[model samples]
Target: MKSRKRKIQAPVGRAAMLSLQINMLRDECCAVAAQLMKRKTLDEVELEDCARLDDALAEAYRILRHTVAKVTLARLRRKSRTRQQ
Candidate 1:
């Protein structure tokens, strides 16, 4: 028996374009977090930390939903097809 590896293909068309945009957006998100952390006063830093974390978690959830929605949809479609058969 021979061992084999499967290769993953790069996304095409709208997916590729959207991936590029997402990459840029992710970088911007990092910059925003860094900026948020640069506040001076003790109170300001604590408030900024809390605010930044809340915003970051929300943003993460949104990004996860967007990307994972595609996977979930594909899985559902496959399951539907199986049921049809």
Candidate 2:
């Protein structure tokens, strides 16, 4: 007879997905920052590209930071509620 066991599932929550996207954006920002730093001064095209990347990175981090804070708060609340019972 074969034993039955359930397979472990990876996180599929919004926060989890956002965390992944945040990491991808972080890597992209590093690449863009390195490319920009290599040049003494940005040309018009490079300046525009750098500006867009900077804005994107800022927005990504804002959302990521908020999501992480919310998750942490929720976990703490759960723990406190259990302890109070």
Candidate 3:
């Protein structure tokens, strides 16, 4: 009998793929925030690339922080829920 498993190749290393995914997610978050600020005052708009980069960095941090928090919370909740059951 032949093996039925299919192997997938990564275009880049694991670290590189994680980095790129984080960067893309950060960019997407920043883009959404930027669009929300488009109708705001001049001071609310990102006028410099550095400022935009900063926002992206902050958003990335928030994403990571929230993801960790959520995972931890879910794990803890699962334990409690299982105990209750």
Strongest candidate by lDDT: 2
RMSD of each: 9.2, 4.9, 10.7
For model 2, how does the per-residue alpha-carbon lDDT over 1-85 read when each residue is reduced to its tens digit? 9999987643436666776776687677668767877888856576577668767867876887677777777878988999999
Off by over 4 Å in 2: 1-42
User: What TM-score goes with each of the models?
Assistant: 0.42, 0.55, 0.38
How many angstroms is residue 66 displaced in model 1 relative to the true structure, after the best TM-score fit? 2.5
For each candidate, the alpha-carbon lDDT, in order, equals 0.63, 0.73, 0.63
lDDT of candidate 2 vs native?
A: 0.73
Query: What clash count goes with each model?
Result: 0, 0, 0
- Residue 68 in candidate 3 has what lDDT? 60
- lDDT by residue (1-85, candidate 3, tens digit) is 9989976643334434555577776677667667656865654444465466657776766666566666667768988999999
